[model samples]
Target: MPLHLADLVARSELHLSVVAAPDRLDRPVEAAHASELLRPGQWLQGGELLMTIGLLLPMTEEACRAYVQDCAAAGAGALVLGLGRELPYQEAPAPLIAAAEAAGLPLLTVPDEVPFIAVTKAVFAAKAAEQHRALERVFDAQRRLTAAAASGRGLTATLEAWVDATGIAAAVTDLLGRPIAAAGLDDLDPFGPAGLPPAVTELVHKVAGRGLRGSASSASGSLGSVEVQPLGANRLRGLLVLVGTLAPNDRMPASGLVSLLSLELERRHLADEPERRRRSALLGRLLTEGVSAEHAHDVLAVAGLASDTVRTVAVDPSGTSAEMAAEVAADLALAVPGGLVRVHDGLVEAVVGDNLDLIEILSRFASGAPAGIGPAVPPEAATGSLRQARALVAVSRALGHPAQTREAHSARLLLEFGDRRALRGYADAVLGPLDSADPTGDLVRTLATWLDTGGSWDETSRRLAVHRHTARNRIDKAMRLTGRNLDDGDDRFDLWLATRIRQEMKAPGT
Candidate 1:
C-alpha cells in the first residue's frame, strides 16, 4: 500500500493533526517537501506533501486562499504547516485552514516538538517499500511464465501458466481472432470464433487490420475488462487477449508474456514447415488424381482431415499483400488440425473440414478480393467440389465479394419468393421417377450435368469424375425413367428446368 496522509497523521510520534478537509486524507503522499516561497507549487511534482512555516507569511484571507489553491492545482497531496511561537503563526492560521478546507486539500498541523524531517523520512520509506514489492511481483510472474515457455509443452501450457501466475484469464488468437490456445476460459468455448464475445472478436480484427502500427486496446464488458495485445516483431503474427482487467502493476508482466508467446509461435511455425509442405503436396495430389485412391485416404488420415465431408476454397492471392495472404493461408491450413492448404498456379487453395465456421474465416481474409467456398462432399468426391470452387471464384469476382457454390446457382435465392410448394410439385411431376429410381442421386446428378452441358457426355463425365460410358448410361437410364427425349428441344428444356428446380428446392443436408 502507498503512503497516504492518513498513515502519517495516525502516528503518535509525528503528532500531525488533520485540521481541515479530513475526508481527503486518503490521498497518497509520495514525497514531502518544505518550502518558504510564496508559491512552492512550481517546484513540486504531483503526490507530494507541501510543508511550510508560513514564512512568506501571507496573513490575509485572499492571499492564503491563492496559495492553497495553487498547491492543490499542482497535485500536492496535502498541505502541512509547522507550528511554533518563534514562527510567523503559532498554530495553523485561521485564514489558511479555511482556504485548505474550501479547496478540498487535506491540511495537517505539525506541533512545535515534531521536526519536518520525520514526516519526509516516513513518506520516502513507504514509497520505497511499495516500489520494491511491485518489482518483486513483476519478476515473479516473468520467472514462472518463462519456465512454462521453456517446458516445450506448447502454447496451451504457457497460457495456462500465465493465468496461474497472474490470476487473469487469457487467450492467444490467430490473425482471424479465433482462439488457437486459451486458459481459464471456463464460461466460454475455448476454441473457434463462435465461442468468443462479438465485441472482443471485432477488436481483434480491428487491431490485426492495422498490423504492427496498432497498439494494445482495452474495453469494459460483462467480463469486467478485456484487453487485446498484438503479437509480432516484424509483422503482426497474432493477438493476446486478457479477458479481465490486469492488476494495477501487471503491465510489465503482461508485456513480457506477449513477447514470450510470440517466440513460441515463431518456433512452432518453423518446426511445422515440413508438415505443412507435406499437407500441401497431399492436397495437390487429391486435386489431380482425386480422393478415391487408397493412398489418398491414408494421407488424409495423417493430415487430420479424416472426415467424409470436406470443402475446397479458392482465395485470390493477387488481391492481398503478401504478408497478410501468408498469414491467412497458414491460419486456414491449421483450421482443422492438418488441414491441406497449398498455393498453386495463380491462386491459393485449401481443403478444409466442413465442420468449422469457414465463412467467418473467409470473410475476414477476403479484403477486397473474393474467395469461393465449395460445397461439402465425401472425400472421394472432393474433386467435384474443387472444380466448383474454382468456377465460382470467377463468379465471386463478378459479384464483388466472396461467394459460395450456392450463390453461383443464383436461382435458389431468387426462386424462394415464389410458391415453393407449388414449384416442388411441378419439379416432382417432371423428375419424380428419376428421383425414385436413383435414390443415391447419381443418376439425377448425371442427368442434370448432361442437360446443363447441352447433352455432352465428356464434359458431364469430367465434372462428375466418372467414365464417359458410365455417364451416357446414367443419362440414358434417366431418359427412360423420366419419359424425356433428348432429341426434342421441348423435352430437353422441361427436363433441364425441372432438375434445376428440384435440386435447388431440396433442403440443405438432404
Candidate 2:
C-alpha cells in the first residue's frame, strides 16, 4: 500500500489534531520528501508532506501567517509544525493554524519530543514497498504481452493483460476512430460525455498535436480519469487510451509507465508495417496483371478481401511498381469495405459493394496518378471492366486529355479507332499544323483518300480517277505537306490510322 497522510500521521506518533478542513487529509502522500523553509513563492511538489518548525522565522503572528501563506502557495501535500521551542508546544499558534486552514493545506502538530527524522523514515519505507509491488505488476504485464504476441493473440488479449496489471481499462482504436481492442470495464463508453470525459479529450488532442503521450484527470467529482497516447509508426495508427479510477488516497506512480507504453506500442506497430505493406502489394499485383476472374477471386479470398462487386481502373505513368501500386490500392480498399487488388502496372481492380461511393474512392487513387476509371460493374464483370478501363486510358492518352469521359459509348469508339497505330496518326495530325502551314487542307485530304483505298496506289488512283503515278505523287506530296514521310514504318502507321479516323468521322454517326 502506498503511503497516505493518515499512515504518515500514525507512524510519526504525533498528536493527531486536524486543523481547518479535515477533509483534505484524504489526499495521498504519494512520495516522501521534506522541506523546512518558508519561501512564499516556491512551488510545492504535489504529494509531498512538508515539515517545518518555525525556527527560521520570528514568533510574531504576521511571521506565522506568512509561513502558512508560503506552504499554501507551494501546494504542500501537508504541513507538519514542531511546537514548544519558541512558541508554546501545547497548542498550534492560532494565527498560523488559521492561515494554514484558510490555505487548505493539511496541518499536523508535532510534539517537541517526536523527531521529524522518524516520520521521513516511515514514509520512505512505505514508498519502497509500493515501488517493489508496482515493479512486480509491470513485469507480469510484460510477460503476458510477450506470450500473447508469440501466440498470435489479438490486440484485446494484450490490452487485457495491461488492464489487469494496472487496474485500468485499455482501449485501442484505429485511424478511422473505431475501437479495435478493449479490456476491462465494458460500460466505459468512448463517445458519450461520460465515456470520453472532457479532461481525457483535451489530453488526447494535446498529445495528437505533439505526437506524444499525455494524460489528464476529470473534474474532482468524476468517476475516473484517462491517459492518451499515439501508437504505431509515424503515428499513423490510432490512439491507445487507458482509463482508471485510482483510490483517492493512494499514491500515483511516478515511474514513467505511460511513456514506456507509448514506446512499446510504437515499436510493435513499426515492426508490423512492413509485413502489412508486403501483403497489400501481393494482393495488388495479382489483381492488376489480367489474372483470370476465378484466380482473382481466389487471391481476394486469400487476402481477406472477398467481395461481390468490383471496379477496375487503369493508371498512367506506368513505372509504378507493385508495392507503390498496392499502397494506393489499399487506400482505395479501405475507402470502401470490400477488397481491392492491382491488376496490372498502374491498374487497380477493386471489388467494392454496390453502395460504395465511386467518386470518393476513385478520387483517392487520382491523387497518385492520372487514372481512367471503368464502370463500377459487378465482380463477374471485373475482367471486362479492366479491359474497358484500359481502352479508356488509351483514348485519354491519345487525345492528350488524361481523365476526360465522353458518352458511355465513347469507350467502344476509342477501342475500335484508338489503337497504337491510331494514336500515332492523331499525334501527327495534331502536330502537323505546327510542322507545315497548309497541313489541314492538303495533307489531311490526301491522307484520307489513300486510307480510303487501303494503301494501294492503283486502287487509290481508280477511286480518285487519276493515274497511278499521279496518285503516288499526291500521297508523297501530302506527306511532305505534313512534313512527314509516308514510307517510314512509324510514319506510315501514323498516317494510315489518322486518315482512316478522319474518314470515319465524315461517315454517319461520327
Candidate 3:
C-alpha cells in the first residue's frame, strides 16, 4: 500500500514500458527511493523502488547483467530507468532489459518528457495517504482497547478482543512458563502442543533478556506462524504472539495491536507484582513448616510449579561475603529447573523434580562458588533437611572449614560434635601438632579417654597405666598444644568439649 511501483507509474502519467519481466508483479512494494549512480546497489536498502538513469556506466551486456544481479541481491522491489538524449533512446536496450528480466528485477522505463520530480512527488503522496489510513486504524484500535481495559476487563479478554478485531491469534503467559489466556485458536492450548510450539517456549524463556517479536511456526501444523513480543518489566512476563497468514503480512496486528498489547501486559504485570510477592511469601512459609507432600504439591499448584515430584537442596555460606553468597545462589537457581527461593538468612532453598540430574546440579552449585552444601533430599523432607543444613553451617563455622552431610541425622551429629569447645581443644592438642608435623596416625587417644572418664586424672592415669604425674603432664602438654589454659575452671569445660570432638573424629571410619 505504501507507494508500490504500479501506483507510481499510474500517478506519474508517463509512457511507462516494462523492459524487464512481465511475471514479477507478485513481489510486494514496501517503499520508494531513487538512486542515479551505476553502483547504487552498494547503498541499496531492501524493499525500495530504485530510480536511476543509465548515465554512470557503459552500455554493455556484461555491465547491465552485473547491475541487475546487484539490484536483486540488494532486494530492490523494482527499477525505474529514465530515457534521455544523453543515452541512446531509439528503442528499449535489449541486453539491459533481458538481464533485468532474468534477474526478476521489474524494470519501468520513464518518458523523456516526465520530470523525475513528478514521479517522486506522486510516490510520496501515495505513501503519506497510506500512512494516514494506517494511523486512523491504529488509533481506533487503541481507543477500543483503552475502553475495554478501563471497564475492568482482564488483559486476556482485552487481548482476545484485540486479536479478534485484528484477525490474529494472541496469547499471554506468566513468568513460570504457563499460559494464562489466549485467543484466535480456540482448539489449541497455548501452554502446550495444542497451542504454542517448542520454539515459542524457547523464545519465551529468553524473553527475559531482550525485547522479542518475530515470526515462528505453530505446533498445530499450521503452514504459517506468528510474531511473539515479550511483555512486562525485564520481559519477565509472558509474550503476545500474533499469529496470522496474510500475503504482505498484516500490519494492523503485527505492529499496531502488538504495541498496544505489550503496553497493557506490562501495566498488568506491574500492578500484579505486589500480589505476586505476597503469594511467594505464603509459599515460602508453607515450604518451611514441614507440610505434607500432598500439601506441598497443592502449594506448588497454586504457585504454578510445573513438576510433580521434586528434590530439595539447601545452601549455606560460612565465612564468605554475603554478596558472593547471593550470587552463587542466584546462579544455581538459574541453572536448574523449577522454582528457587531464598528464605531466612542466606539460605537458598530449591525444589527440583526427578527430571533433573543430581550430580550435575550439585556440581554446578559448587562450581565457582565456595559454600557448604547439604545433601539432596526429597521435597517432603526439605524442611527437616534444611534445618540440618543450617546446623551443618554452624558446624562449618565452629570448625573453620567447609563441611557437608547428606542427611539431617548426620548433619546433627557433626553439629553436636563440633559445638563442644573442649573437644575441639583436645583434638587440637593431640592431633593438631601430630597432624601438622607428621601428617599421620592419631595421638588424641589419651585425651579422648580422659574426657570419657569425666576429666578424672587418677582414673585416666590408671586407664593408661601411667603415674598420675605423667598423666597430669600429658594433660598439661595437650592443653598447651591446644592453646588453652587447663588450670582455669572455665577451661575444664572447654577441655571436656574438645575431648568429645577428638573421640568422634577418632571413631572408626569417621
Clashes of 1: 0
Ranking by lDDT: 1, 3, 2
Model 2 residue runs over 4 Å out of place are 12-23, 30-43, 56-62, 84-91, 101-104, 167-181, 188-309, 315-340, 346-348, 358-370, 378-380, 388-510
Which prediction has the highest lDDT against the true structure? 1
Pairs of residues clashing in candidate 1: none
RMSD of each: 11.0, 12.9, 11.6
Score each candidate by Cα lDDT: 0.80, 0.59, 0.61
- The candidate with the higher lDDT, 1 or 2, is 1
lDDT of 1 by residue, 222-304 (tens): 66678888887765668888887787788898888889998988887768778778888888777775446576577678776
lDDT of 2 by residue, 1-510 (tens): 666787765653655556655778777786545555657336566677776676665656777778877766666677777666554355666777777777777888777676677777777778888888777765666666666544556566667666665677767654333456677857655445344555555555555444434434443224355656676443334567666664432223312333334455555655656655655565455545556667766765766666666666666645666666655565454445545544454565544545655554454344435566666665546657766767677665554444423423533355444564665566556546634655446446655677756687777777767788876776677666666775677766666556555555556875
lDDT of 2 at 213: 40
In candidate 1, which residue ranges exceed 4 Å CA deviation? 9-24, 35-46, 56-75, 94-105, 111-129, 184-194, 215-218, 233-236, 288-303, 306-309, 316-328, 336-338, 355-359, 366-372, 375-377, 391-510
Residue 369 of model 2: what lDDT?
Answer: 57
Q: Candidate 2 has which clashing residue pairs, if any?
A: 44-74, 84-89, 284-342, 287-342, 287-343, 288-342, 288-343, 288-344, 289-343, 289-344
